[model samples]
Target chain A: MSAKGVLVRVSTYAALIVMALATLFPLLWVTSIAFMRAPERFAGTPPLWPDHPTLVNMVNIVHQQRIGYYFLNSLIVAAATTPLSVLVAGLAGYALAQAKFRAHRLVSWIVMFAVLVPNQALVLPLFEMFSAVHLINHYAALILPAAANAVSIVLIQAYARGIPADVLDAARIDGASEWRTFFSVVVPLMAPMLAAVAVLTFVVSWNDFMWPMIAMQKVDMQTLPVALASIDREHYQNIGLMAAGATVAILPMMFVFLASQRYYLRAVSAGSLTD
Target chain B: MARLELQRVSKLLANRQVVLQDIDCTVNDGELISVVGPSGCGKSTLLRCVAGLDKITSGDIRIGGQRVNDLPPQQRNVAMVFQNHALYPHMTVYQNLAFGLRVRRVARAIVDARVRRTAVRLGLEALLGRYPRELSGGQRQRTALGRAMLREPGVFLLDEPLSSLDIPLRAEMRRELSALHTALGTTMVYVTHDQSEALSLGQRVVVLADGQIQQIDTPDGIYKEPSNRFVAGFVGWPPMNFLDGDWLENSGLDAHCIDYGIRPERLLLQPSSSADAFIAGRLERIESFGGEWQVEISRNGSRVIARVAPNPELRRDNELRLWFRREDLYAFDRATGRRLQG
Candidate 1:
């Protein structure tokens, strides 16, 4: 090959290697900090590798910090939020995409506007509403608000747009009722997009720091990120334990994302590009 | 067997533009009719209206002599094959074909028998276990056809079902579709923008332009006796050429008509003659197309084309006189763009 071609090829590989390192560095550093013996983690110059790796920090986070209960709480909130939001948003998306109503355009614009409004602005009013209902510390406070997500609805709407209009028309002609058409035809067609929305919503609910930090005040009911922050507050110098808790919080999201990476990527791209 | 009719159907878009207006055509019992038109001419909209997918703005659609305008698609007993072959991507070919039947609560035995029969007929027996993505474009189209066929509805609606296939595959599936129509003898309304497919598969062709029916006739009649300039231009490849020349002399030869039309095949390259309408021109280009040569000639600032046998002696800028028999010429109303019938 020509010298120019060889140089281009080498540069491409070098860039990819740089990118790979940039991505892997944080995860590796966090994991290393999580396993380091406290002495090594607190050393003036933190060593890349622990002289002796230990499980003490992990066990301490689980037992002493009550990380198991927080982990369970995060799981419950995320699990509840993901499926409910995906289902509701998926139905709304299908309706907006296929069904004709007088207010269709109006509803779509409204949803778009809602997506632009950050959740931070809604926290005060949402907290006030939950307090009046006496469900401020309950799981409903998180799950209910997360269930009607505008971004997920828009993602599903955009994905469903690519499904040829003929298919939906065919389903209508085939005697499938509206709900049956949704569950049978639209849902099956939407599996890839739904998997993506599920992962995203689950990640959002699991890693929600600000809202859960405010609503889940009680220690027993605190979600993982909130409880992790509390642990960090009390053990400011216990870098090992805090790192272990952060890793525990990050692992499930990693699994969920990696497991459905193809679908997640497709949905993200489709949402941004397609009509 | 069922007959389908559209009665002055019209579609007004959200912008309130009349997309389709006064579309009236009928598919008699067991007959296949193709609606041929240019893109965006609303042929698909008419099909959707008939399939109960779109609502008619001011008219009614009748299937089997019963009004279906107010009915839902499911209640209207129509099955459709989409342009993209809309086979459910997630399902195996067998399940894709079985979907409509299962939705209707068809007995397992009956659905199996019908699907098996359709698979064998479409030569898709081997591919039934595969997903739509695994099948070739032709196979996916057949599977879509099979899905509609299994429903066995009163009328079959196909919206450019073969448009997605490659040219060779489209030709093969066209033959298969015609044969299937013959065997089943179902009322079918096929829509396409391709004139050849419409000409070959449909027993009758409805030529539409700008949502209005230009002519409804057999293939031969439509090609030979197009109702207007739009039909003439829209229905043929290398479309019929038009020249806006006034009639110079009208005499005892009964040649009073003007605005003449002739297909490229109707123009003959002959020795010069003293004929009043004989056009003399300089050959601008010659294209040898295997079976024949398509020659373009310029005359009096107008261009005309003639398909002739490959004449190796013919050179560029060669002078030639092309003439058409008066009987072969079509006269159109200059103002109205409609054919002037003798």
Candidate 2:
């Protein structure tokens, strides 16, 4: 290889490393502090790594605040939301992309417009509708509204368009019913996008703070993030304890993302249909 | 296996656009019929209607002497080969070939036997484990054909199935398709915009334009006697030359009531002076297409093109005179565009 080419390659790796560190530093620091002794956390010119590691903060947070229960609540919400939303969005996206209808363009426009609407703006209406249905403080309050996600639909619709109408039509002519075609043909072909959307839905549902806080007013019904904030109000001075709580809270999503990382990459560089 | 018939079949989109209107045609049992038209002449739509992929706005379609308008595509027992060869990317060749019967819950042993038998017939046995992405274009095309062939439907609908292949591959597939048609003896409808493809492959050609069928005849009949002006203009290489019928006015004929066309091959450059008539114009340009040269001539703002033997003496901007017998020109009604019988 030429000297110039080697230099370009070296510099590209350098830039990527810098960006990677920038992205990972916050999460790494929180994890590091979670294992640090309390005195080291308050020490002057705080060290990046824990000088003497310990699990006191983890035990304290779990024992004192019932973090496990709140974590379970968050998991339940995510578990319900991800599969339901993916299925709904998958069907809707497939229809919007392939099915011909009188209002096809109109329905497509509505989906695009819905993506632009802020989630904060819908809280009031969503709350009122849920309240009317007597679902406040219920897990359904979180799972129901999210099941019909617009952004996921748009993501899926963009991917689904790449699935040629010929494939769908061929299936129909081959004796597959509409629903069977979707499951046997479209679903398998769209696996990468569905996996990516599943991860995104899980992360968003697990980490959501604003609506869950307002809806789950009962202390025991509160999700992890809401319960963590309540703990944060009184224990603002305990940085190690807060770090421990944050670290535990971040673990589930980390695992979810890591498990789905390969499919996520495929979704990003989507040439699944060709391969 | 079955005769297919369309009686006054019409398709109108929800946007109130008429895609096809009053299309009346039929395919005898075990016939290979081609529907030829321009790109938007609704030829694909016509094929789709027969396959039940698209519903007709009105009229009855019969297969095997049974009304099939209300039957779904699967229940209708019709198979289609799309222009793009729509093999499932996620499925292997074996799965693709077996999909039709598998969906209907056919016996597993029978499905395997049929898929294996077809793979051998199409020379695709070794590639049965491979996905579509791993196959070459011709291999993919064969897989698509195999998928449809395995269905063994009463009627086969092919929408320009070879349109995506290269020239050599297209000709090769065309020959294979004819042999397969003959062997199966199944009624087949092939839709294509390529007129020559229609003529060469079809036992009968159905010409269409402006959302309606123009003419349906044998290849020889269509080329020899086009039913109207559109068929004449659309179904020929280098096209027929249309001249203003008024050019015959000086010959004691009332030309304003008719339009006229002459095939380029019929015009003689150095004719006997005793010919019935002549068209004189300036040779605007000459294009050599290997075996022959097509020369365009303009006369009083009207253009006339003629295909002639490659002549070394033809030059641009020169005066060119071509003579034709009066009987050689095909005449059409001026307003309705219908052929005016001699």
Candidate 3:
């Protein structure tokens, strides 16, 4: 209502809009290049929007480079990983948060330790185990290692602490078995955290590069990121083709985030579930 | 309906703390028994042991004449209504009421019938679809009671179920609990730290202090004849006033041999000089509520609190005389806290 307040509000929003544009500029540029004409991509200073847009790069990547196949491979890995990771992480987290079995503190310390151990550092031992088991090229190599995620477990365990022990005891007094109580009471109570863990697993599995690159060495079995890198070498000169492929690769992550964003938002405001 | 029994039921924490010690009690079939204690007195722990929610370090608990020490909560055939209601936050009232029957694998038609009937009985029919978070505290508590009602277990264990409610709602729930107990006539073990709740609602009351049972008696018996000094002080509101045995100049009781306690309400504010015992002290404080007043009288470094009718003429710091019948005085051993017979 005041002149100073109005100016401050206007300038704040203007600054936010500029920052948002800065963050989105690269994705926007790649999307524009994906539709640009071949000659437009080669222009000395490329235009923000292509004057002559075409789907030639998209067609080439799908038909010749088999980007669709690689996309499918990525989808399979992520789809398998999300629910598996959610289940394993949720159960372990709830136990760490509430259950009173022996060595609970020790196990919690171990999980915290695991969270500090970087995923990249485990590549050698993981590769060795997969090699010994003779399943290095299989989808199991991607899904299994990620299913028991320490960070997700920690997130879930912290959230699960909000669940009062009385509700669990009520379930027990009601003749519900431990498994029945978990599915009927605990799972719905932990919905937001589980949803959050699910989206994180999906996005990470979809965009993973180093492990997928080493594990899926076979050309036909490679996931989107590894396959995209392989194509990048041959199509380094063709910006249009590379952008088209990158655009396709970004779709599923966006889709997964959008699909589960409601519960993901709830997770940010968690721990008000119990009295 | 079932008879509940505790046979020297003792609980020891992992740190070697004695929580409950050699507690023995019994509740006849179809009776409502209340356990009352101060916080950390193991009243809730005793209920949990009966519910099989906590394991006793030693001793046996029985329901329906069957030893349930080793039984899981589900197999013990008991229902518990927790202090905070403990209704599943995510479940609607209907689902919460139906949970017990559903988990016991009762047929869907029966579960629905029982849940709806119980909801209607508790006047929760219209709010069946609302989750616990959407309901008021009273509504949540009723839903919890309904859930336990649906179980139709051999015994019901309630752990301070009305403690979270405000004063008026607590009175309402206390009455409702009594009505429910009368209607079902199932063995109910209600635990609360409120002496009035224990006295008003229970057919019998068990008073606990410092992880031990001080007394188990009818409400009137617990009030009229406390077994020890702890029960005498803990059970009554405004607590019993203690007078040093040595301080009373003409008393026949041996000095330092017995501790004397008298209920606040038992003290009279009359100026009578004929009674066997009486106290005179400067009026120190006055507190009034619900048409009754409690005043503190002090003299010669001694204080006596007495609950009496409102006296508009009384002024602070004025020397006041209070009297009690000699028979009203209670004596306990100074060291052991055990009752001393006249």
List, residue by residue over A25-132, the lDDT tens digit for candidate 2.
Answer: 998998999999978988864579998899999999999988999999999999999999999999999899888878999999999999999999999999999999
**Cα lDDT of model 3 by residue, A184-274, tens digit:** 9999999999999999989888989999998998887899999888888987788888899999998887887899899999998775878
Best by TM-score: 3
With candidate 2 superimposed using the best TM-score fit, by how many Å does residue B206's alpha carbon deviate from the native? Answer: 0.7
Interface RMSD of 2: 1.3
Candidate 2 stretches greater than 4 Å from native: A1-12, A44-46, A62-66, A102-117, A121-137, A217-219, A270-275, B245-256, B269-327
Location of the lowest summed lDDT over 10 successive residues in candidate 2 chain A:
A38-47
Inter-residue clash pairs, candidate 2: none
Docking class for model 2 is medium
Tens-digit per-residue lDDT, B1-342, candidate 1: 699988888889878998799988888999999999989999998888888888889877899999988999999989999998777667799998998888889999999999999999889999999998788888888888999988888899999998888899888889989989999999999999999899988899999888889999999999988988778877876778675542223322333444666778877776335333455579999988999999998866788888888878888998976666666677777677888887
Q: After superposition on all CA atoms, what RMSD does each candidate show versus the true structure?
A: 4.0, 3.2, 1.8
State the C-alpha lDDT per candidate.
Answer: 0.85, 0.91, 0.91
Positional deviation of residue B324's Cα in model 2 after best superposition, in angstroms:
4.7
Clashing pairs counted in every model: 0, 0, 0
- Which scores better on lDDT, 1 or 2? 2
**Could you list the iRMS of every candidate?**
3.7, 1.3, 0.9
lDDT of 1 by residue, A1-275 (tens): 99999999999999999999999887788888899997797778567777889999998988888889989999999999999999999999888887779999999999999999988999999999999999988999999999999999998898887777766776787788888788887897788899988998998999898999889888788999988888888999998998899888889998998899988787666542211
